[model samples]
Target: MRGIVLFFCSLSLVACQDPAPPPVEGTVKYTNAQWWLDGDFAAGERCAQDGLLVACPAEPSLTIDLEGGFVIPGLAEAHNHNIDNNFGFTRMNPEYLKRGIYYVKNPNSVASDYQYVEEDIARPQTIDAIFSMGGVTIAGGHPEKLYVEFLSQMPAYMGRDFDSLNSDAFHLIATEADIAPTLDLLQEQGAQFVKTYLLFSEEFERRRDDEAFYGAKGLSPALHLALTQAAQARGLRVSAHVETAADFAAAVASGVDEINHLPGYFVRDVATTEEAEAKYLIPEDMANLAAEKNIAVVTTTIISTNFYQDNPEQLEMVKAMQVRNITALKEAGVFLAIGSDNYMSTAAAEAQHLVDIGALEAHEVLDFWIRSARRVIFPARKIDCLQPGCEASFVAVSEDPRLALPLPETITYRLKQGYELN
Candidate 1:
């Protein structure tokens, strides 16, 4: 009877594959394939398994044809609003998930823009539909866009203009009482991290101007502390838009896990501020604070390239600042992650920008990019490299991203969850 029971269990195991075994897309091992699994420095070396270029020594076999090209981990967007980005027209299909940018944040769309949050975001089916579009993880929330409707219909209680409204706009964020339930709903819907864009309200701006209430009321550090604690209680992480020095410092004090966007408009490295009113100035000391606390910085340099688009000089300046910060952060031994922050552009462009201006070499950039995404979903393994037992997530760029300018024509072969793209 025991033998019969064992036989039945074995049969059942072979009959079911609910987890969905990974499809064998293809196998690739290249003698000339420049491979970097998230921070490995083995550049210009031959890699193979069983005498092939890149083979799955242990797998339900798949093969890929690199044709003497290069392979690296796929890219990620460290700070992106895919919903807002999808609004404008662009050359490429912005939502193409194959490039292995399988992660996104705040997928707001035209529907979400027009619909009330309570109606649109409060339902599980609606949230699941948004997630099913192929973002494995997303930043949980979105702040109001600078829409004319929001501007024209600014609440009577709120003040006028972008500055006045944004300064004290903690009201925009669901309060501590609301955050817990909202986060609970998000977790049920598979959200990985909570995100909020920083925009101040008129009251906040006014208080900022006044000495007595430099950081009080809705803009108080306590609010962030509350938010962070709430997220922590539920094992969620927080990512915030820290565009200015004051915002960056406040975010750090509140213990936000990661910072999106590069730190510009802040004091230069190893420099002191002479300005009497340094409200938004991020001193060098803040960098030290971030480093000591083990906060990862996502370098969205490529996104900034698109910014100041009309102003060539300003664009160039932002790029220069990125280069400097990348170097500074690396030297400081801070973990760096690469995010495209791109909307409606080819992955080639995003990857190329990182190689072109950032401090990382081609292979290192690939590792940084993937590691960021892995962190987005699973922060525990902060430094996930291409090692045994790791999830197979990589990309095959037609050429070495470090040396060659990623031509729009060059194809990027994406591999995620052990399945290669068709």
Candidate 2:
């Protein structure tokens, strides 16, 4: 009877086993395309397996006849907001993917909203990966003010104050006690980096003319230093959002890994007609120090938006100041990375702006996204290039981006992890 019972249990276990899914179908090869390798195109037959390239087999399993197109490494958007809905555009919109921006680093967004959008929303086929830093800033700081709309939408914490709820989206650190726990919580929530904000307060902004209030509301140097140390101890990179020269200096001095936004916003009162010209100067010494310390800067190019506005004189002034500031940073050997903020299609524009200002060459601008930017975002892995052993992901274009005058119009095709995008 015991043997019969054991036989029945074994039969039940076998019955519970599910059938294997069908094998993935498709050959993985692109022919006649100029494969970008080591900053130049090379002719070679490439093959991939399980999203990574292995030694090419003599008889390929799959082959795509490209008939001559430029195959370059996938592009990364270093600074972005993964808002659930941004002016009617969802986070995984195909428009972004079509432009060859296969990866995005969303620095700040409501955690619940980000998780909801990421899980519920149908992502575009072209998206290779999405990294979130989780909600960032001190309690009642920059993003706390900016993301009011998103925060209001969360039902669990709606109508309650931000301080009362232990939220995943906004890791609000009001004191030194909040730093380690916040970093740990964010790490548990899959945050790849730590994002901190250094924006002027409304009261401080109102009293900008008063010299005493320059560093009044933002993160104190001591707090910044402590935060960086804690984050580094946990192996997370610290990227700070700073607008003014003072904020930039503080961020660098505190040992933050990267600085966001150009220095013009706070370096001078660009809006104040009387003082704009007087304050239009980049702190060359700070640039030198940042370079020596190996801290990178993300030029979001908020200044370039002014060029399209009705203020021609302001545009000219801003353009000149941007050129000067970027030149100084480049001369100091600062690792400049590209970030569009909310402007999704502006990476090319930012690159062109750098080239127009003579700060970086076309290839160097490409390298910002291809190589330098990837190093900042994915420090543990090398996935930004098309070399063997790198992840099998790239974008195909009709023209070489390096040679194209204003960058290629759009990506003709994209592949992520050896799978062709629809």
Candidate 3:
């Protein structure tokens, strides 16, 4: 009887010590919660809240206390000009980098693009290595057609063409046919998504057709369509550099998923000719269309004001348009992703600028930024917010992000998949 009683006691002890059930399998909760989620409330309900993440009810994970600080998604710069930001073009002088700007998006400030390539692309591996190291994902631009233009701009570096440079340094698909080839290369190289060059207005496209622009190397909408179709076939969405409304319209009409910048500049007629063209501002109709279609817009609102002075007029325009555009989309149920087009050292500064310029409410900008990044980086995956069965991605910042704080500093404390990087 004593032996049996002892055996029963041992069994009960073993049952009680079952190791807390493995932490509810993938859950992280904010200790001092004051974060408000805006996009897709259903999605937010799954992962974001003040209490313990219900999914992992039994987990003993780290508690990130923001001291009632604001929590939002990690920001993404969807329409960023890659070559310019990482290659030391914006702040440095490279003659070759400048020449390429006429044809390609120049990241260096130089006279000849050939020299730019020599100085920058000579160490191709170094270029992409920086992006990988940034703890951020990017949509890289192709460097082929622009290379031809670079050659024309600088005959000295012409001998060492784009193909001669390390293709590994950048993803260089120039045409529709190049899509599959590029995808294969990226898959082998482990790229997240593909980026395209400037969108041409129907008028500009016609002009190019007349000149057979870029020596007949310029990509047409048809080619773009083909590339998008191929990329989507391989589960990739193309991000095009759109400047005007026509470009935006064409991108939407082509059935691409997202527009890299705001469509305000694109939809207007900046033609120098006296001709009757259809006027298309950021029309309420188009906003509705975007919402109904569920097409995502990455409003790099902060960067848009970078070129134009943030005067009262521009600020008011940004404010009204942002409010109307965002409100319209929200009313129509459009998904908006926020990004700072200029991914400079002052990244967070740019976010503050967005609020200052009235592009978004102080409280709501973070969610928009995160959603934008998630949409472009992972168009297919439903992984924007923290939720059960969702990829764990969130940020913890002190105080509510929506309210304006003096010289605000946001500290990002988390990354996707639950790695505490505070």
Candidate 4:
């Protein structure tokens, strides 16, 4: 009987032991902190990187004491334009790095672009960015008159002429004929993505001939659809900028990959009027359609709220509309990203705005700012996670943000591509 029992036990042990050695798990002294893997709290978790990551490494060659700090993937800005002017390089890079923002998507940068400042950005110590060199808009659309004409006088844009700016900074697509050439120019300039303007799309034709509407109106409905399709065919993702709910609906119907700004942020044409604000409310059908097509959206609410600051009543009204639009989109399961779209600001500001307005729970907003937003900026890369195969770039905080988000000043460490950055 003893011999039979020993034989059975030996067989069982052999069956369990033949596979392989388990990956080493990391140990931490602090029970209060947890390593965030993508969006989950992972305790006693270890990761390794050889360019890409290997979770729970068999033997990690590197070890840096976290000193009980909490960790999260680096943040991103989905609708930034910090590359729009030559001077932006000197100011934006350090600011973005300090904020733990590792990825920036410039929806519409001016011509000289990243090539002009490769030294500052291409380094592992600096943040990475993708450029959609210029955006396609109507002849006198939103940015054409403002970015090309008036701003050209500024020291940052001194010698750039209106015609050259229109050609290289922002295209003036007066008709369908302009679509192919605009896309061609963008590709030639090495654009990673494409941006199309759709300001008050429902009123495009009506606003076209009105001199008063110049610089306010955007692409026609037909042309908007055509441009999106053409850009996609050329292997570029399209991000549409919209104003009214009608414009939002038009963007969704046009089958664009992303919507740059949430509608109802800024009231165009007739400001402060409830009738005008009503046009800002997104319809359930439009939201549903956007979800069905897997279109992502970036929230650029706070900056637009400045347009109504003088009138508290209208500000509240706009907030109410934003809440409704956000609720509708969330219910439809659309992927929402964090973006300031205000060159002067970063994702942190936008995240705070969402929290202030109760647009999302604090934790959910933090996830968007740190995890989801990075993926939105660069959909193909292995980013925004500490999981196996993810690139090992992360930000370590001294406090658990879920309980209370500490100020940026309190951040203990910021890492990029496995190297600790000051």
lDDT scores for all predictions? Answer: 0.46, 0.61, 0.43, 0.72
Which digits, one per residue and each the tens of the lDDT, describe model 4 over residues 51-155? 445654455554566777788777887777755544565567777777788888888877665577666664566778878887888878877777656656655
Model 2 local distance difference test score: 0.61
lDDT of 2 at 313: 66
Mark the regions of model 4 whose C-alpha exceeds 4 Å error after superposition: 1-33, 55-59, 271-273
Comparing candidate 1 with candidate 2, which one achieves the higher lDDT?
2
**By summed lDDT, which 10 consecutive residues of candidate 4 come out lowest?**
1-10
Which candidate would rank higher by TM-score, 2 or 3? Answer: 2
Backbone collisions counted per model: 22, 3, 24, 0
Ranking by TM-score: 4, 2, 1, 3
Candidate 3, residues 270-364, lDDT tens digits: the string is 45211212332355666677666667766555654544454555445545555555566566666666544453322344456667766567656
lDDT of 1 by residue, 1-422 (tens): 00111111221111111222344344433334556643443544322332123424444243345555565554555544333221221111223344445443332222223222323331211110122111111112122223212432422222344344231222234446756655555555455555544322213445433544322223335556677667767766676555555666776777777766665522222232323124333356777777787777766666665446586765666566667666766666666755545544433455668677755777666656656656553444322444444445545667656555334346455544454443
lDDT winner between candidates 3 and 4: 4
Evaluated at residue 262, the lDDT of candidate 1 is 61
Q: What is the C-alpha RMSD of each candidate to the true structure, in Å?
A: 13.7, 12.2, 16.9, 15.3
Better of 1 and 4 by lDDT: 4
Q: 1 or 3: which has the higher lDDT?
A: 1
- Which structure is stronger by TM-score: 1 or 4? 4
Best by lDDT: 4
